[model samples]
Target: MSSHVPPSHRRWPAKTLAALTIGAFGWIAPAAAHFQELIPTPPLVNQNTGATVTLDMTFTHPMDHGPVMDMGAPKRFGVLVDGQTTSLMDRLESISVEGKAAYQASVPLKGPGDHIFFLEPAPYWEPAEGVMIVHYTKVVVDAFAADEGWDAMVGFPVEIQPLTRPYGLYTGNLFSGVVTRDGKPVPFATVEVEYRSNGLIEAPDEIFITQTLKADANGTFHYAMPQAGWWSFAALLEGPEPMANPQGDMVPVEQGALIWVNTQDMPQPSTN
Candidate 1:
């Protein structure tokens, strides 16, 4: 959401690499917020579906500097099920501990396209780390969704992956029966997400991750779905966006809005 997609640790596996590079996100650099980093993020959604992914988190040193997490013992931390915050808490659902002792969370996509996720650090077992001013690290993810504005006028499928796993997906959803103003298909147009992060970021170059897709000449498109969640995808009415680019998916796509998409908990219009 910051002009750039947040950093996903996948690009830098070493603990030291992450620490030294903390300044990349000036605001998250040891800021006094309830922020913590959950390595290998987007923490594999739907474990209930038997689809579980392992995620890890780190502290500067002596693990004891953190808190006595709810999962208990090495690799556990307290969690917060946050949503409804749309501003700083958008795309985030629940933050809990995983069996691997890493932080695990369940996030519902808001629509299709690109979106932001800010993971708050877990409470350290000790009060010092808990009270210390720590900045939050960010990871970027691609999200796909349709009809985010409740108009049901447009629809699309979207994908979002973060640098943490570089290849690790974070969202995948679908939308059906999306139509254009003239009863034409929105394919061949384009789909993208317009976003910003918690930091007071400006300029497109500051963004982190953005995944763009184009509909075939027939106005239909297919993109890789990272995982399961709500997503928001859009089409630029006027431009040359969607390209064979990864790492950063947007910027070129400017001035477009939600079209057709798919998401969870949303009911299709009943023909009955």
Candidate 2:
């Protein structure tokens, strides 16, 4: 049998070939929910440990263990303690996570109280979804034995105000918070939750990767951690107005109010 094709049938146009290839392989997969991670190394700060805590800031899909996205310098990064906010932007050190730009900082605990660390990441242009994503993210670290200020608000455009203390939680504790935008509750807001997987555990299905829930009329939502690890709660909403993309076309923006909390397993009974 002849392996050669006739001259008339030989070459296909570039557009035609590209169309055929795409039809065979299908289009790109849908975009997964993006999470802006602002994680503290030792989630809890206490007297037994050191005075300085290291925090890692990365944009990723935590449950999937990433195809980490490059992150620009944050618009704002700071800590709030006892009704005062201090800027930590000057201390940020550039780093790389999964070959993508990330950041880290070491913050020293000055005294006992809840240190609320917050980050307003530069708006990320997500071509996959044709929108910009800006997550106003925060996490609370309890210093020494002072748990009083754990619920203080950071005053982000969109943020989660914790109804339950944000730190020192057991694996099964119910973490609750209210979704607020401009300091007012967002009634019936949508919240997404994901576990910071250690890459050892596997999701049985794609649906298990990110858990979705809705807040009540008061904008309060709750979820009990099923495993011992860090968990994130993101209350999603639309930005006030469309923002122009790089191409100078106005597009919608996704504003996520996110908070991260850590949970640990209860200590087992010691054998004598």
TM-scores for all predictions: 0.25, 0.89
Question: Clashing pairs in model 2?
Answer: none
**For each candidate, what is the lDDT?**
0.32, 0.85
Worst 10 residues of 2 by lDDT: 1-10
**lDDT per residue as tens, model 2, 151-202:** 8898998899999998889999999999988999888788989999957778
Q: After superposition, how far is residue 111 of candidate 1 from its true place, in Å?
A: 23
Error of 1 at 28 (Å): 21
Q: What lDDT is obtained when candidate 2 is compared to the true structure?
A: 0.85
Per-residue lDDT value at 227 in model 2: 93
List candidate 2 stretches off by more than 4 Å: 1-30
